[model samples]
Target: MNRTVVRTEDLWKVYPQEPKPVEAVRGVSLEIQAGEFVAMAGPSGSGKTTVLNLLGGLTRPTRGRIWIGEDEITALSDRELARLRLESIGFVFQAFNLLPVLTALENAEFTLLLRGVPAEERHRRVRELFALIGLDGLEDRKPGKLSGGQQQRVAVARAVIGEPALVLADEPTANLDTATGAALLEVMERLNHENGVTFLFSTHDPRVMERAHRLIHLVDGSVESDVAQGVRGGVGHDR
Candidate 1:
């Protein structure tokens, strides 16, 4: 049986506002198993990002609990959460947060560097992913020298280099052109199939939704629908 990499129970996030509180996530429960390519899809203010953030330990929930692998996130301290993220979770955001001063290879290996990976093994692992994520020859180039797509590829490579149990991506394809987005999707797809890495994305892009094995549709802070992949004539829900 595949391990459950992420589990959330009755999660909620309420932002305090004048006269009223905004409920970003309301009573959400979810389970994501190993190797699943899942997308959290919803319109704006629907809590897709909130759910992802809770899962990734980026934000504390207003109420309820989350488990990433064996760690119960709600019970952890801030420092513990930081350590957990460094060791077990990876993040890819819309902005492709690569350091301007770092080379593609350096940016890709940044997390590993934080963990004190030695030079030879770090180069080996990052170099291997450059090919997998399609950033091969550009390893020596800095972020400013790369195209938007290439920068995102470097980000993706960085996220998975340590083989984290879960990768959370928010609007991953949001800043790319059509062709570039598709190429990036293809790279992610290959990694999930071949490497058994779990991916969870929060996105509204139909292209990203279409490529996912499961679509978790959130509306007004709750699940509107949970859809298996129907595009390929195969059922792919929560498998």
Candidate 2:
């Protein structure tokens, strides 16, 4: 059986506003098994990004709990949460957040450097990953020198280099053209299939929804439907 890498129990997040409080997530309970390619889809303000932020330890929930591989993130101290995020979770954002000053290789290996990995080992791993992802000859280029698609690939390389248990991507393809987005999705799919890297994305793109093994739809801060897709031979079921 596959291990459960993420679990949430009645998760809620409310933002205080002048007129009234806004509920971003309500009573959301779900479990994501290891190596599943899942996507959360919804219209604007459906709490997709909020849930990812809550799961990634980027924000504290207004109420309820979240667990990543048996560790209750809701109860952890800020320091402990930071440590847990560093060791277990990776995040890919829409903006392709690479340091402008660093070379592609340097940006991709930043996480390893933070963990005190030796220079030689870091270079070896990044080089191998670059070659696998069609980034072999661009290691010395800076982010400014790369195209939008190339920058996003470098972002993905950075996220997966440390071999984190889960990667949460928030509209990673939002900034790319259709062709670029499709190529990026293919790269992620290959990683998930070949390396068993679990990916969870919150996106509005139909292309992303179509390719996901499982799709979870949200409306008005609640889960409306969760179904497995047929594209990857996934069994259909409600969560």
The TM-score of candidate 2 is 0.96
Per-residue lDDT of 22 in model 1: 96
Model 1, 103-170: lDDT tens per residue? 99999898899899999999999988897787889989999999999999998998899899999998
Which digits, one per residue and each the tens of the lDDT, describe model 2 over residues 27-48? 8988888888999999999999
Instruction: Give the number of colliding residue pairs in candidate 1.
Output: 0
- In model 1, residue pairs whose N, Cα or C atoms come closer than 3 Å (at least 3 residues apart or on different chains), thus clashing, are none
lDDT of each: 0.88, 0.92
Worst 10 residues of 2 by lDDT: 230-239
Candidate closest to the true structure, highest lDDT? 2
Candidate 2 residue pairs in backbone clash: none
Best candidate according to TM-score: 2
Candidate 1 weakest lDDT stretch, 10 residues: 230-239
